[model samples]
Target: MKIVDVICTPGLTGFYFDDQRAIKKGAGHDGFTYTGDTVTEGFTQVRQKGESISVMFILEDGQVSHGDCAAVQYSGAGGRDPLFLAQDFIPVIEKEIAPKLIGREITSFKAMAEEFDKMTVNGNRLHTAIRYGISQAILDAVAKTQKLTMAEVIRNEYNPGAELLPVAVFAQSGDDRYDNVDKMIIKEADVLPHALINHVEDKLGAKGEKLLEYVKWLRDRIIKLRVREDYAPIFHIDVYGTIGAAFDVNIKAMADYIQTLAEAANPFHLRIEGPMDVEDRQKQMEAMRDLRAELDGRGLSVELVADEWCNTVQDVKFFTDNKAGHMVQIKTPDLGGVNNIADAIMYCKANGMGAYCGGTCNETNRSAEVTTNIGIACGAKQVLAKPGMGVDEGMMIVKNEMNRVLALAGRRK
Candidate 1:
């Protein structure tokens, strides 16, 4: 199908605020200074905000598909504004990206995405929001044309012989470093502190030493409540790199911090993300290598996940190729489009590294649905439920989509 027209609309997904008192090194932003007990980087408790741009992909066949831009809010750990960045999508997609796509054969999402990357502003890559909007619109239009699930289209287009396995649903509980808990609470929360079905307030709310104590509580609670009687829940925590930050980026101190969590999550290995975020990619990789070595040297089963600065597919591959981190996240928006994202996940698989397909609560059901398929088609370790604050809502959207895709695939077989 050829692209016919592209339209954009900008609006607030929800209100969001950040105090930047992230427990660990502040996953997205590194320079966290303390004002008494709290971090001083934009410290405030006003209501947080989330904004998104709606994209309509019009094809020559009169078929219209939808997409959304606006990755997770906290991606600013790289020092960028998501909402402000989202505003650029309207002009960029309408003026720059749309021109290249109109009347072009979009049978290959991968091909068109490459062209979109070439639509840079003054040698700078398009802002993630712009890329995300353009990428999703293309993918949505392609999927609509194929009469298949998004995951099915992804599997057919990329990752030949790829298994559509059940992507593990990672429940994001409690608070985020950049999220304001007091103001961002969901009125329909079945699980308090988390919109999903887990209670991790003690684990996430505690600071410093209390982190250890609360983690133990979190472990026991997960085992008792979340896991089956015969099964142990794998304890996965995104540390926000505060452990490394608190330890002054000392490898031993950071490893020691992880060891404590490892011990707390005994019998089940702990998967930890954002141990540290350094000034540059080299320093970040160096920190990753050092921390991984320390964890290995101590015989800790803690898996060090690289999230900070591993923003793009190249970044993820760099981490995987160097063995810098045990797991590298294929952050969907960072990879620009899902087609590029699938290849990155395949890269992780080919290299024997763990791949986590993740997104932020700052997305919509449409975006979450698309990534859920990408995660399954690429055989990722897990996919984060997102597009909204409630964990249950994110989980519901992604999990339901996975179920639908698999069922349809079965019938096709």
Candidate 2:
């Protein structure tokens, strides 16, 4: 199929973007908005509405294959691309990108995705959001051209020997961690409650007592509310490095505290992500490696997940090769092209590192659906329910997409 035309539309994401730097610096929450000066650049407030651009490609057969260009919730922090605003980038796509995409042949997804993913304007590569969305459209176009599901295209091109199956779905509970846990339990999410424990003093507590209490409560609640006695969901919490702040980045202390959490979780598995953020990639990797070693040496079964500094496919390999964490969250938007997501997940599985196909709540339904296909195609350990922190909507989108892909692929056999 050949690209006949290109279209771009400005849109809203499912959630708002928060300045992570400002939030960490003690920005108080007022209702859903933050009450403080914005720390990161390209922000009118500490929190603002998220924006997206839908890139649609018109093929010769008149099929419209589209993808949503969206950024992470904590944009511009942790070595990511600067803030993505539709007003600023829509024109860039029309002027710089649309021309190149107009006459391209939809021959190979991997070849075309990598070409545009590395394309640059004004001496810098295109923003990750743009590359992410454009690559999705490319994949969809190729799938439509080949009369196959997106998952099938990825499997055929990337991992022909892989089986198309459903991946475990991990859901996030934004600030409504308490009520949302009920929703997650009711739905029986495979990975329950990514309790957003960003603040040390409030969420994690000055000495980590608050999070411990929360984990205990979570364990009890799951046991009480589950419909089946055997329904055991993994407890995966993202602390955003609050544990490190509370314990002064002491590896021994952090490991000890995690042991307490694991005990609190009792029969359930526990995976803690971003336990400490040293703010530099090298330092962050070393901390993760040391912490993982400490946990293993003590025979602790708790799993450590690498986030923050582990943003790209290269970062995933770096952390995986060093055994920095048991699992690495392949944050979809940060990796630019969807091709990298496929490669990262395969690499992690090959290296015996858990690959969590995760993306931001600050995304669109299209992006979530696309990533779900990629996760299933690559055989990732877990796929995140995304586009919103509210458990139900995100779960429905991800879970339904997985089922639909699996059903369609099954028919082919």
Candidate 3:
């Protein structure tokens, strides 16, 4: 099929873009918004509504294939691309990208996605958000031409031998950490309560006491409320580097504290993400490696996950090569094209590292569904239920999409 036309439309994401730097610097919360000056560049406020652009390709047969271009919530931080305002990028798509896409043959998704993903303007590559969305459209277009689901297309091109199965779902509890746990428990999320523990003094406590208490509470709550004893979910919390700050970045101290958390979680497995962000990619990897070694030396079963500074396929391999963390979060949007997400997941799995197909809550439903399909195709360890902080909506979107794809693939088989 050939692309007959291209269209772009500005839209709002399910969640807001939060300035992670500003929040870490003690920007107090004020009724769903922050109360401080913005620290991150391109952020007019400490918090702002997230933006996305829907890129639609008109196939020759009158079928429309589309994807949403969106960025992470913590844009312009951790060496990522600048803020993605729809107004600034829509024209770039209409003028620069549209012409190139129009009249192109939709033959191979891998070839077309790589060509545009690496294409540059003004001596720099296109924004990750743009590459992300355009790649989704390309995959959708190819799938339409082949009369196959997106998941089938990926599996055929990337991992023909891989099984089409439902990846485990991980749910996040943005700020509503307490109430959201209840929702996650009811839904039986495989990974429960990505408690957004970002602050040092307030969330993690000066000596890491607050987080300890929360972990104990989370364990008890699960044991008390779960209908079945077998409904045990992994406790995966994103501390956003607060644990390192609390323990002065000492590997031994961090390891000791992590052990305490694992004990608090009891029978449930514990995975701490972004334990420490040393602010440099190399330093972050080294710190994670040392910490993982420390935990292993002490016979601790807690897992460490790398998030910050591990933004690209190269970064994923770099971290996996060094054993930086037991798992690497393949942040979908940060990897630019959806093709890279598949590459990252396959690399991690091949290297004996857990691949968590994770993305920001500040994304559109289309982006979440697309990444979920890719995650299943690549056999990621866990797929994040995302696009919002609220548990129910994100869970519904991710879970339903996985079921539909799996059902279709099963019927075909």
Angstrom error of the Cα, residue 252, model 2: value is: 1.6
Give the candidate order by descending lDDT: 2, 3, 1
Lowest-sum lDDT 10-residue window in model 3: 23-32
Give the range where candidate 2 is weakest over 10 consecutive residues by summed lDDT. Answer: 157-166
Model 3 steric clash total: 0
Candidate 1 whole-model C-alpha lDDT, 0 to 1: 0.67
Predictions in order: lDDT = 0.67, 0.94, 0.94
Model 2, range 1-413, lDDT digits (tens) per residue?
Answer: 79999999999999998898998798997988999898999988899999999999999999999999999998998778999999999999999999999988899889999999999999999999999999999999999999999999999988897889889999999889999999999999999799999889889999899999999999999999999999999999999999999999999999999999999899899999999999899999999999999999988769999997899999999999999999999999999999999999999999999999999999999999999999999999999998888899999999999999999999987
Candidate 3: TM-score? 0.97
Instruction: Tell me the tens digit of each residue's lDDT in model 3 across 1-413.
Output: 89999999999998998888998798998888999988988899999999999999999999999999999988998788999999999999998899998999898899999999999888889999999999999999998999888999999998997789989999999889999999999989999898999889889999999999999999999999999999999999999999999888999899989999999999999999999989899999999999999998888879999998898999999999999999999999998999999999999999989999999899989999999999999999999998899999899999999999999888988
What is the alpha-carbon lDDT of model 2 when measured against the actual structure?
A: 0.94
TM-score of each: 0.81, 0.97, 0.97
